[model samples]
Target: MKTILKNHRRKVTVYLGRRDFVDNSSTTEPIDGVVSITYRFGREEDEVMGINFSKEMQLVCREIPLKRDVKVTEMQERLLTKLGASAYPFSIDIPDNAPCSVQLFSDHSVKQ
Candidate 1:
């Protein structure tokens, strides 16, 4: 697993392999300019009378601006050329109090 420090900034490069893969004409809003990250936690309970007994919570919702004109690595450049993908670069500043990712198994064990 990789560890990222809190309050530190990390650079990420996003590569879209196909431009025509998404149908933008069907949507009223443009799908560019921002990157959003959301954390969801949910638990399933007994379903009674055809009602869903699942409980869910939105722990985090964050958005950062998608930037461009950044430099790419040599391997990324080669892959971009080979796959004909476009790259978008951005940096994320992890908040100091951001919660770490966690998963709970059916056995009641937790993993981080």
Candidate 2:
């Protein structure tokens, strides 16, 4: 799933669905599905200062459950189909001080 949030936004959106394997098997069951977000910051090197290093910190993590545990009523199925996707609705609050996604110093990366 891909989510885009403006600087003023405080929420993260996600889409959940079943993952099928190549053999027609499945990975995660929809009933116990969960969506998680991990916020991270890191640097590979500070070239101007001539420093070579790696550092990282995990600033936030959140997980939300899905509603597939119970059988979907006919009405619910119809509504979901009308939305045009089999994915479930999910969202999470972006915590205060959560860093914005960034990358620097070639080979470095940061994500929120």
How well does each candidate superpose onto the true structure, as a TM-score? 0.26, 0.27
- Measured by lDDT, the strongest candidate is 2
Query: What C-alpha lDDT, on a 0 to 100 scale, does residue 67 get in candidate 1?
Result: 45
Measured by TM-score, how close is model 2 to the native structure?
A: 0.27
Clash count (model 1, backbone only): 0
RMSD of each: 16.8, 16.6
After superposition, the stretches of candidate 1 with alpha carbons farther than 4 Å from their true spots are 1-68, 71-82, 104-112
Candidate 2 lDDT over 1-105, as tens digits, reads 123321212122232332231221322222222233334356424334543325545544544345545455453444345443333434333344544443333
